[model samples]
Target: MSRLPHRASRRQFLKLGLGAGAVLGLAAAGPDILAFASDVSDFIRGPAVPDVAPTQLSEHVWMIWSKDGFPTPENQGMMSNITFVVSEKGVVMLDPGGSVQIGEMALRMIRTVTDKPVVAIFNSHYHGDHWLGNHAFEDAYGKELPIYAHPLSKREIEGVQGSMWHSMMERWTNQATAGTRIVAPNRTVEHGAELDFGDVTLRVHHYGPAHTPGDIAIQVVEDELTHVGDVAMDRRIANMDDGTYVGTFRFYDELEKNASSRIWVPGHGHPSDQVLAWNRELFEGIYGNCLKAVEDGSTMEEAREMVLADPRVAGKAADTAGFESNIGKYVSIAYLEAEREAF
Candidate 1:
């Protein structure tokens, strides 16, 4: 991989760039300084950070997935999958990881495949885990890269929602997210928009509010590959804290109409048709059970228990860790949405 020009050494990073004032401020913060320093060093050097290698899904498309675990220093907040497409013009990245370090790792992986500069980044939604890595691109290239997201996503990342997410990320990573900053997408993409990157063209589609209000799936026209963000988690029950259950099922129905023989890359987990089918079934079952529970006057807890006990959910939830909790949360959200719709 080609290294960035004028890469600073550790001493130079502290003495020349960061200086004594920043160092003293960090030192005064106590143990947090250690995590902060580690983050800084990773950002500066971008050395061989250990992460999953890119998987070639098609001739022009490659995907790098983070392990299905909570963010930690070891993973550098790589809790989402990143897909990049190589075109004659430059590289187009989709959903670039969670933090600055993770974004750096994604850049390193992209370089391993092609030396083309990243010309554009498309964030799938408003989730911090997907786009906070925008900072890394700016850090590496010494300029702001063009980032695109749905209009609602742009609003969310620029409002209180983005601030709350940033605070949560800092706490979750224990300050390993020190250099990560919220660089919201500068441009807003609408449904049915086509982005041409010379050789490769991406058709952006947002059926409705499924994963998040601004969830946009990017389909590489030549490859027949769709990067469907958290709208479709391959094998696990995706968190619904920011999404609606009914909208997810609708998105799945829309996907099925065109998903035949197409390669689908999820926001997390590996790509597979069977995984997509499983998620559709899971969403359908959750929606049905939530509606039933509401009609039966069941409490949110009751609805959660009932949904978890269902064969379709229980069987799939057992395959992945942390899904039981995710499903539990989803049931609660679903029940609330169902109640609101009933009125």
Candidate 2:
């Protein structure tokens, strides 16, 4: 709730996006007037980002988020986040950005770290914010690099229309092209699997139906690194649009410790380990809010209102709606995984 002052008005932002001069001038104006710019900068580190961001998180890992148009991307293209780790096998990347352009930038950046081929590409989930840029990166690095995901991811990629695929790239990253067509997963596992990057071992944990049916959590086998795709979100509302609320509770419980990780990489936001316990608490709280609504015989819409009205949910209402828009969708999805029937 404690946020920095906002810099530009919406109208001012729109105008500044038209060119660079206005944006630069606006950034120089005053502290309050620069809040929005600072917020956007904190959102990602690339292109127009401030000079303060440290491009490297460590000798082998990176924290990355890609957005274009921040420009036209607000309405189209993609806003993506990625994590890169260099292992003796090669550089293994988790989740490509929203578009090929963004993905390409990520790839190039990875090259900056090491010339090793991108041996493994992990699609954190089916979402574009996480995986749409697969094509560009795959073509450059070779699709045979072996895509990894939950079984459903491969099915979604190969299915006709692959409806989610097209819409996500087009709307989120604004990149809708044949090259963006996704390739199904080559490796699929349930529960958890460990990937050995020669010198480094990575543990990928799959929790059923949270965020997406294929939601998985990755942790550096022995180091202090963990990637909790969308299961553990930041101040930015978690994207439950895919129907993971009920399962998210179970998923949250699985991550009971963070002793193994010194740095936590969320699907978005800066990496930190402090979120382990906090994320667990947040999920429990969200699940409780939704369960109470279900107990009250509230309709999905009413359930949303009830959840939003709770002090726990009130502050996050705006972010919560990002996932609650299709209340019925979430309930149906969560119901499938709920321990007890809510309806």
Candidate 3:
């Protein structure tokens, strides 16, 4: 069989091994069970997404906004925004997207706005939703394309984090992101590093760990706009699995002190001047109460009640995506962090 992109060939190799093991496990299973398994295998394949037009946010920055906040088969894993900067030199991509299909769709949209090729790519973090689309861009642009990320992000993406995300996205989208292979960033960018692309310049900003240890925000100096990545979301709760509330607060402070971009672009939401403020208030509402609860020796349940009752958090509950299902976990994470700080 021919080797395919997105590691479909490698996946088949692994499936063969698993298939041998399944012989024993499914020895007693009826025909119905086998039929269901066959259906699942068929569902693993997905096609390209429909072309989505890019919306211009600044003079040079354009964004292909994703309507869905979470990955679903119907949306085919196009749950993250794809932003790019057009310059005299060429185009610079910020978080290409979540999968090959989404990336291809973004490429089609890019043609509508500008004919220049994508010169460089910058990944915000290690999350698959943010960078899995690297496969598409690298394929289109060639192997020599410069994909940039923080050192830690590059390491993580080359390690288990890369494979983990690839699998997780397949599971989340029911394999709608089937053909996406791991394409880690080839170049690394650190805080304070600046890339001058003729007409526009992008400055890198990484303040410890906010969304992830490797998260890097790119600042467009000419446009007076900054792509904050997952560090701060516009109206959504950022995933804190690899992050800390304290660190997030500190990141916000450091970002404000340094980069003063008029607009902030997030990975999951629209660009806005109030992006940082909106996320800060919501985080404080959740983490502040948790810290107070820890100081008072209150239980986790009590801390959750306080967070829910917080006007800042409650007000956004109706509009926030995945709020009801994820708030409990976020509150728990905050409570644990608060406890650690108190001690």
Off by over 4 Å in 3: 1-45
What lDDT is reached at residue 287 by model 1?
A: 71
Model 2, span 4-50: residue lDDT tens:
33664433444334222223236677886577455543332222221
| Each prediction's whole-model lDDT (CA) | 0.77, 0.59, 0.87
Model 2 clashing residue pairs (backbone): 7-33, 7-36, 69-72, 77-172, 77-173, 77-174, 78-172, 78-173, 224-262
**Which regions of candidate 1 are displaced past 4 Å?**
1-48, 142-144, 258-261
Q: For model 3, how many clashes?
A: 0
Candidate 1 local accuracy as lDDT? 0.77
Candidate maximizing TM-score: 3
Q: Please, what are the lDDT tens digits per residue for candidate 1 over residues 1-343?
A: 2332456564456445553224334755566675665455454433234656998899899989777656665565667888889999898989888777778888888988999999999999988888988878877765567799999999999997777676677557545565566788888899889988888889888888988888998888888788889898867678788788778878877776754437888888888766568787787677778888898988888888788788877777767646755667777778889998776
Superpose all Cα atoms of candidate 3 onto the true structure and report the RMSD in Å to 1 decimal: 6.6
lDDT of 3 by residue, 1-343 (tens): 2222454543564365533223323635877665644443433446779888899999999999999888988998988899999999999999998887788888899999999999999999999899999988998989999999999999999998987888788778766777676799999999999999999999999999888999999999999999999999867777998999899999999889888989999998888989999999999999999999999999999999999999999999998998999999999999999999999
The TM-scores, one per candidate, come to 0.83, 0.70, 0.88
